[model samples]
Target: MDRIGLTTVVFRNRFASTKPKNQVLEDELTLLSTPEYFVDRFKVHNVEMWTPHFESTSKNYLKELKRSLKKERCKLINLQSEGKFDPSDPLEENRLKAVIEVKNWVDVAKSLQCEAVRVKSMKKSYSKAVLSLNEITKYAKAKGITILIENHSDLFSDYKNHTNIIKDVPLNNIGLLADFGNYSSNPVMFDSLKHIAPFTRLVSAKTKDFSNQMEHIPYDFQKCIGIFEASGYQGIYSCEQWGKANPNYDYEKITDWMIDNIKESI
Candidate 1:
């Protein structure tokens, strides 16, 4: 149970102050105050921070965030380091630029004392993604931070391609961040989860919808957990409720349901 955590993305609606005007929700929560929310609301100390919640990667901002986490007795276990740049771009200059951006996030993760950071491969070329990840992993290794490649968007949505990218990276610090709901279909999603479970360092327990009774309806959520446990995965299952685009849903109920389900499944 201590391994359970929640991603800030589940509360995207409450982060109006940091999000863009079009994306803002009804409430607000700065990254500095998120730790307290996690502690008080969830009764958990582990946090998986979404990159967008960060006001800035500046040293002073990171120092303040660290202090806040310490004050709340919370641990930032993972940083979901998202960006627009394509790390696997064929163009050398473009790829290097993306590499630099990810490296900067690695520096941020180090400053926050996060155990791992999640990144993505946006292009189809595994070789190119490998090149970019190698550089990023080398940089992260020195900081004692692990680099995670999630099954997110574009080429990585396919399990074979995603695992190949990790296999090709050839670095110990590089691993998979298995996401439960990133695939195109139910069969593919479960198959991919099974294949990547052994390599997973963290999990994005993504839930899209729930029943009135709080049951996960998209797929067999318990079966998903069973697969990872069968594969010997014993890491943080960061709860993420990626419901429909609408903000009218009950986020608190959805999050509570997810946490309870994950606890029961594990």
Candidate 2:
């Protein structure tokens, strides 16, 4: 927590208990602002905010964000440029839409004083996402944008494929935002984290609710830290806490505990 720059996500589903959007947004800020007050809290800033619930290609979307970013505590934003899971989009149209959306995001990120915007390397349709990404990477220099891809489910099945895509794109500005637990659903989590960290410009320090589990879960803190260390990864390890929670688990407490355990236990 002390040396690391952190990030938080603002998923609409995470606020389901709150009745109104206004109320939910207010509650989210309260959680954020409290860290500003924590006595022993290290300097924390630069949060990653998601894109619109809709596609970012809308003409008015950039206009709306420009008007609103002034009100939020978002001096820096890790803007996710494309987000479509479930694999239902037509390959050609989706690729075109993503390009336009990323272009719009570049304009907005500059206007909003945002540092970096994340993007997908490509989709399962190798030829399309690859083709589009290559074009974007070529143009990215003039645009002053860097693309950071997560090991997002389905988009990247393994490190070999992921590394190949990074190679094909050939942009020094482009790199991985290695989500530490991306491969947690598989037996290869640690290895995947190790392999990708060298290419990492950002990292999502993923954690599960050990407190929520009925039995002791096996997450090696030392191994996770070792991967970053061995890779010479000196970048933001943005904590991502996912999966179920229990009645006894305090969300903030869980995060603070992980920061202490994982960082110090190393």
Candidate 3:
């Protein structure tokens, strides 16, 4: 059966303090909301955690986290790692660093029993990025976790680039994380989704505002879900509530409403 999940970044503001420029103070938000809180309160059985919201990936810490998830009966669907992942960086050292960092996240994914890890693409180096991702995919395969490439920014927002990366990656363990709200308009967004649907392993349904009819504004949830169904995608539609379209409304309230819309569409 298809299920719904959420990314930790959806509640980023509530997760951490944006006040401190320093990284240390920024992590204070993670302390407030945790895996336990998500499972117990939201009743989400599947979760996609953002790496920045976490402080450590030490063995003991991960062990405890795994224990907590098991206790709550929640599964870690994906681990969204935030770092400099443009393998096509002009500098060789930076490219090397990106690969190493992503590989480390793969290890963490293993510890968390996560099914996939989402990484961003480089706007500069398509070929180099593919090469680097191939290496990451090789490592992820051994750990039994998939490497997911998301259409997050710059060149990645283009559907052609997403398909190119998928075709050139040359790894079976690599796939795309199709995000609904990434594109600028409905036509382009739906077209891009169709292009990458064959490669999609997960979906990030980013919602900002809803209409009075309980439908997602700007982008139609019914049509979006139709595209997913047409593409034969049967996975969690991760509700990622972002953007400040309605600052007056609380995000949790918006999330609840989005969940209802998603249920109706599904």
Candidate 4:
């Protein structure tokens, strides 16, 4: 249960987005049909988990997601939304919608029994970052849910920037979803992981096949595990892979290696 788990997206190429719900379901079945050797090896907690596509253009999205969670027999660890929240946007209409949608997402998370929801760390000034998190933290605390920020967009570009946001909120319920194998473009994956490790409520061991990449290489996952341990991070490290190349990447096997590394580093 302490080891990392792969997101459903890893096993399938076509099931990339929200559409074709049946395809997504099919992918889940295919992933579970085997012996799940990796699951046991890595000490994976569960076979099923999802990051509900909350940004789709479809109505009744939340309801569909609720049904999907049950049908898929998976826990929703993260709810990915599209709208950006900005505190310094003097536009009252924009700010109003941002607050309302956050409130609604809280309600949805409660109904779905989801433990965490993903929020974007907006590209705002340092002071604005704190102000923005303050508003988001109030809503999270009220709903009894945790807000985890992904290094999506500009927010994951720097940990120091996010730390400012963290200082402003200063709440247990608001934390980071430490991501790995990402922010490559920004060139600070390891640094970001360490910076967010202490506040991380959930962790993501994001993997990639960079054998063909010109600049960045595939993450030194084992070393990254050491970093997580050094920071005293004990949260789940979800494997969310990108692209079509299937490494047949075994989560259980990798997790076995990573956890062992964690133990050694400490």
Candidate 5:
């Protein structure tokens, strides 16, 4: 139960105003205040920050964020950095640019003293992803930060190809960020979860719909947790409720349900 934490994606509505072009909302969660909110509201010490939630990456801003986390005694476990650059782009110049963008985020993760930074496997070419991750992983390794490739979209949807990219990289600091609800079907989802469980450093316990009784209905949440546990995965289950942005739903209650689900399953 203590292993359960919160990802900022669960509070996307509250954070929408932080990004550019989004309407400023009355109730907003800034990067600096998120740590205290998580501790006060959820009693959790670990946080996985989304890239869009960050207002600035300046040194002073980062220092202030560090102070906020220290005051609340919370740890920044992972940074879900979704930069616009595509590492899997075929162009050499574009690939180099993408590698640089990810390296910058790696530096940010290092500055925040986070354990890992999650990057996307964009486009369809596995060879191109390998080319970019090779450089990104080497840079991340030197800073004592782990590089995580998530089953986000594009080529990563295929578990075999995703694992192959990791195998080709051959770096100790590079690993997987397994999400429970990212696959296509029930069988494939479970099989992919089991296949990648051994290489996963962090788990995104993604939830979408819940029954009136507060039971998760999209898939077998317990079975997903069991699969990872059976594979000897010892990592934080960062709770992420990724559903439609509904104003009626009580996010706090949903998060509590997810935390309880993961705890009971474990």
Candidate 6:
């Protein structure tokens, strides 16, 4: 059975605020859930973190987090690093800065004992993005963590962009994090998933509106799982849900439904 996991983005509403690019500002009333919260609430053994939900990446913070995860017998599977870093920035100085920022997150991921750290692709220029990721991969490889490129932004949604980088780089440490719904509800989502499935190390099993009868409304969960199955992807299908999208639905119920659906499929 594929391991089920939860991403921190599922509880976006619980965060303190979304100002200055949706990064958690770490203030009172934030209601940000801790690693233990997910372990206790959902009973999941695997966790994927989106950077925004975290209050800090200091050594002490990460050390405590790792201890908490171990205490609960939960594994930190992947870290979605700050999305603001763009390795393809046209400005030479900015691109260098982006590398440093992502490198720092790589170190952070290492501290947390995460298996992989996902970085956003630079949409403007593939060559430059490859160059940037190559450097980042070297750093991540040294730290014993895989570097993942997700199908997030428009360029990454194409799938070929992801394959192109994977081919050009030719390093085992580089892989893809496939997200089912990031292509704006495109019809070819499954095909795109098939194309990139071979290179996928983890999946962002994104979910949206559900029916009153507790069925997934926005995407075909079974067919997507079939694709993953055929591709031999035996890995984490991290539940990446947005609770606020359907305010009327009980967020906890919806989350449980998503996890159950994936568990049944796998």
Candidate with maximal TM-score = 5
Model 4, 124-205: lDDT tens digits are 4545456555777788888888877766556545777656656677887887777775576424777777777787777666
**Per-residue lDDT of 51-163 in model 5, one digit per residue for the tens?**
88888999999999999999999999999987767999988888888888889999999999998999865875689899889889999999999999889856887899778
CA lDDT of 125 in candidate 5? 68
Q: List pairs with backbone clashes in candidate 6.
A: none
Q: What is the clash tally of candidate 6? A: 0
> Candidate 6's residue-wise lDDT over 40-108, tens digit each?
778887888777777887777777788887887778888888756578877778888889988988988
Kindly report which residue pairs in candidate 4 clash with one another.
Answer: 38-252, 42-252
Task: Write candidate 2's Cα lDDT for 1-266 as tens digits.
Answer: 44454444422334333224444343343222422423235344545555543334344755555444444433454666554532222466766777766766666666556667777445467556667667666666566767776777646647766667788788776777777665635358777776777777877666664744432255765567678877776666665566553435455565565566556733
**Candidate 1 local Cα displacement, residue 7, angstroms:** 0.7
User: Runs in model 3 with CA error above 4 Å?
Assistant: 17-33, 210-215, 245-247
TM-score of 2: 0.74
User: Candidate 3 at residue 171, lDDT?
Assistant: 77
Provide TM-scores for the models. 0.94, 0.74, 0.88, 0.68, 0.95, 0.89
Question: What value does the lDDT take at residue 232 in candidate 5?
Answer: 95
Give one clash count per candidate, in the order shown.
Answer: 0, 0, 2, 2, 0, 0
lDDT values, one for every candidate? 0.84, 0.58, 0.76, 0.57, 0.86, 0.78
TM-score, model 4 to reference: 0.68
lDDT tens string, model 3, 1-266? Answer: 24788777766665543322343333333622466776665677778888887667888888888887788777899998777656667677888898888888999999889899887556677777877888889989999999988888656789888888777877788888888877777789888888888778888878767655555567776677678878788878887876654434455666676577678877
CA displacement after TM-score superposition, residue 19 of candidate 4 (Å): 7.0
Q: Can you rank all candidates by TM-score, best first? A: 5, 1, 6, 3, 2, 4
Q: Give the TM-score of candidate 1.
A: 0.94
> How would you order the candidates by lDDT, starting with the best?
5, 1, 6, 3, 2, 4
Checking candidate 2 for backbone clashes, the offending pairs are: none
Model 1 per-residue lDDT tens digits across residues 1-266: 58798889988778863444677356677889888988888887888888888888888999999999999988888888877788989888888888888898899999999998888557656778888888899999999999988888677888887788667888899888888887889998888888888888888888988776766778987788889999989898888877666545788887787788888988
